[model samples]
Target: MYSRALRPCLITFQVHGRHFSSTKQNNRRVTVIGAAGGIGQPLSLLLKQSDAITNLNLYDIVKHTPGVACDISHMNFPAKVTGFTGPDQLKDALRDAEVVIIPAGVPRKPGMTRDDLFNTNASVVRDVALAAAEVCPKALVGIITNPVNSCVPIYCEVMKKAGKLDPNRIFGISTLDLVRASAFIGQAKGLNPKTVNCPVVGGHSGVTIVPLISQCQPAVSFPQPELEKLTKRIQEAGTEVVQAKAGAGSATLSMAFAGARFAFALIRALNGESNVIECAYVMSDVQGTKYFASPLLIGRNGIEKNLGLGKLSDYEQQLVKAAIPELKANVATGEKFVK
Candidate 1:
């Protein structure tokens, strides 16, 4: 799945029984803001393998950030790895970054909802957005910090205030929902999870997560009750991890994989690849909300086009309808935080 998802540096094409190798160098500077955190560490490791990235900057307030970077540097990837510790060096980490991914912030404990993470993560996102606006205003930003339904709005509001808001370039990394949906659907149907494609829309939270099981690629079907059960499982999969960890951590490895997958999609698009589509939470008018996550065609300048929600099954329709109010409230909470 990783190899297929991430484009390597070299490609061989065959023509008229002759093989040719094309070595296209994709040199994009990528920064992982919370490099020492649970998600950031694994995420940085995954990004290192992508030939699309030329520089991988890992930054954290933790003193061990440089150690993490040093550890990853030994892997012998083409991308050069650097670490910046403390707020004093954040500017250096973000400077000229083409893609900025923020997986920094606290993880949800066993009993805590994503909303419970708001106070701390919101502040962290706001500060990082402010720095990004000052240093790399045009960089593609992916917010992985939680209460994502709100944190994304907070990041946008900060950028907007800085007169650097480009709605298309800033994204809330909600690929985990899509990943979880695909995995659950695949397990139930006995298919390869990598080949299963499911589009999860709405916001990235409890009730706001709406999976379009009816529209899954390969056209999978489920009994109505089974469909509802699968959808609920996808929605609450993060909590499942948190509980299973017994408060150790929350969805770090899976979230890192999902975050890396989404980041690579953005990198591929930025490198002029066509039809690079992925779902991300971003400022939008879809579903009468300020921010929504749906399938998007990513291009060099960011969102090329938004493929809005397609034909919805009755159950899917109800899920979306039920999600609106909660999504609005989350957006309101985020927007209010910026003010």
Candidate 2:
């Protein structure tokens, strides 16, 4: 059970100066499993700009995967770009990878829900997880596949069966929900989105996406009806983009940006940066669910601490209550798929 009376403590860190290093031991390799896809390409591009990565491995079954890696390699960054196409090359791509991010999967059409993407994306995630288990079992893995609520569990189940399960290391990338919540709240309150911080919890799906506007860093208030509308918009932002694109795509650009943000945060944490924090869905006892998304304190070993849900409003409490059953069903779906 969550302690509704507890408020999350703010963490602050100071960096006196910036330092750049290129030693062999300092090298960090990151792998993108679906590098040629809509989210993967842009995400790989963003990560290529990072100084923390020494190698970026882009893997996909598509012939042009190497081409995508080549395109990103031209950029003047520290990370060396490598492309691995098809199953035969996946091991090479994941070899020595410190962090692995999976954005490989199909996108949603106008009327499709994230759950509708389960069959295709779940298999993609499962195959990648199997390879990761064999090649880089200890690497920090981030799942960006659709129906993330289920796909995350599939990855975990695979890793568990392989006897390499690390609940702290595997995460369902739910940062996009927080990103949308902050952006929507900022838009509604006429505040700079970057300045607004909203903690989105629960699973990554329709009603399961709970944005704690009451706990937003800069306190904000809205009429009850307005609050409901804002929450709904944040929950369905992906669908809004899908409908806007008219079946062409589904929130690829923004999802890429959010994915890159989460990946960078993980990199920072792995580098032993202090006070690093982010929200992600992972195996937890919080909220009595097998998996839940909440603010997490990221450390050198992945999740150093699970910052449990703090001080929910009555409305927010109800939202969380409504989410549990759906989350359980989603978890069951993923676990059943693997079995």
What digit string (tens of lDDT, one per residue) describes model 2 on residues 183-277? Answer: 88888889987767888999888999999988886889999999999999998888899899987999888888788878877877787766677
**Best candidate (score: lDDT):** 1
lDDT by residue (tens digit), candidate 1, 13-98: 23232212122555889999999999999999888877668899999999999999999999766789999999889989999999
Clashing pairs in 2: none
lDDT of each: 0.86, 0.85
Candidate 1 runs further than 4 Å off: 1-23
